[model samples]
Target: MTRDISGQIAVVTGGAQGIGLAVLRKLVAAGARVASWDANAALNETVMAGEDALALPCDVSDFASVQAALDATVDRLGPPAILVNSAGIAGPNMPVADYPPEYWARIVAVNLTGTFHVNRAVVPGMHEAGYGRILNIASIAGKEGNPNACAYSASKAGVIGFTKSLGKELADMDIAVNCVTPAAARTPIFDQMSKAHIEYMLSKIPRQRFLEVEEAAEMILWTVSPANSFTTGAVFDLSGGRATY
Candidate 1:
C-alpha cells in the first residue's frame, strides 16, 4: 500500500525561497497544509500568493521567537505532524584565525541551535500524536570540512550529530528524525560566498553543476513522508556525486 500525506499539517522553517520554498510547494502539492516560517517579511507574501500556506515571520535562533511562531501556527493550522528544519544562514567565509567571533556565533546560533529550537517545539506534539516526520537540512561541508567555511561547516556537523542523538532517543516512538547533506545549490546564500568558494564547490561535484532547488526539496519531501518509516537517524546525500561515505 502507498502512503499519502493528504490532510497532514506540515511546518517548513525558512520556507521563504530557494530549497525551503520548493519544499513547501511540494508538501502542499502532496495534499498537506503547510505553515511556512521565515524571518523575511517578503517571504510571507511570496509563499502565500494564491496558495493555502500560512506564512509567519520567525527568527529560528531565538527560542521565544520560535515558540511564538509555533504557537501561532498551531492556532491557525493545528498541530504540525511534519517538520522540516531548513532555516539556516551561511556566515562570512574566512580562515579560522581570521574569522570574526560574532560571525561564528551567529552561524552556530542559526544553523545548529535554531534547529534545536524548532525540534524542541514540535516534537512534543508528535509524541502526543504518536506519529511524525522531522527532516533537517545540513550540508556536504558538514561531512567534508570546507577550507574557509569553518563556522558553517561546524554548525552543520553539529546538526548531523544532534539529529542522530535525537533519533536514537525517539527510536521506539512513531516519530522518525533524519537529515540531508546537500552540495551547493543555487540560492541567495551563494551571493554571500566568494566566487572562489562557489567555483570550488562546483568543481568538487562530478556532475559539474550545482543542484537545483527542486531536486533538494524532492528528497526532503520523501524523507518526511510516511513512506520513510524505517530510516531514522540517517543522512541522505545530494551532492551531485561529490558525497563519499
Candidate 2:
C-alpha cells in the first residue's frame, strides 16, 4: 500500500533548479508544502512562482548560514518532516594531485558537509515527530570514480558513506535515510565543466544519454513517502547502467 504525503512539509536544499526544482514541484503536486533553499535568490523565485513556497537564499557550505536558513524555514513552514539534500558543487576537472586544495575543500563543504548541516538541523524534529524521510542526492561518480573529477567524486562518496552510517544509527527510529546515485544530467551545473569533460562523461554511460530530472524526482518522491517504511541505509541506482557494484 502506498502512503499519501498530503500536508507534509518538505525542505529541499538547492531547490531552485534542476533535480531539486523537479522534486519541489512533485512534492507540491502531491499536496506537500515545499520550501526551497538556494544560493541564487533569483532562481529560487523563478522556480517557486510565489506559490505556497518560501524561496530563501542559503549558502549550504557554511553551517551558520544553513542553520539560519533552516530556522527561517521552520518558522515559515514548520519543521520539515522530509528533507532532500541536493545542494552540491562540481569542482574543476583535474586529477587528484593537480586538483587545487581550495576547490577540493569547497566541493566537500558544499556536497558533503552541507548535507551534514541540514540533516543535523532537521533530524531532531523528525525524531521528535517519530517520522522522517531523508533522501540524499549523490552521483554515479561516487560509486564509480571518474577520471578527472576527483573532488566531486570524493565528496559524493562521502555522502554515500555518511548516509549509510547515519541510516544505521537511526534504523530503529521512524526516520528512513537513503540516497540515490545518478548519472550525469542536463542541468546548469554542467555548464561549469569543459566540453571535453562532458563528452568524456557521456561516453562512459552505457545508456548514452543523461538521466532526466523528472525521473530523478519521481524516485525521490517514492523514497521519501510514508510508503517507504521498511527501507533504510539503501542506495538506489540511477546511473544509466554505469554502476557495477
Q: Which residue pairs does candidate 1 place in steric collision?
A: none
Q: Please, what are the lDDT tens digits per residue for candidate 2 over residues 1-245? A: 46699889899999998899899999999999888989898888787744467888889888888888888888888899999989998978878789899998889989999989888888989999999999999998999888889989989999999999999999998899999999999999998888888998899889999899999999999999999998999899998898856
**Residue 11 displacement (Å), model 2:** 0.3
* Cα lDDT listed for each candidate: 0.90, 0.90
Screening candidate 2 with a backbone cut-off below 3 angstroms (N, C-alpha, C), the clashing residue pairs are: none
- The per-candidate count of clashes, in order, stands at 0, 0
Candidate 2 segments whose C-alpha is farther than 4 A from its true place: 49-51
Per-residue alpha-carbon lDDT of candidate 1 for residues 1-245, written as tens digits (9 for 90 to 100): 24688889999999998789899999998999899999997756678743456898999999999999899888887899999999999877789999999999999999999999999999999999999999999999999989999999999999999999999989998799999999999999998899999998999999999999999988888888888888899989998889867
> What TM-score against the true fold does each predicted structure earn?
0.97, 0.97
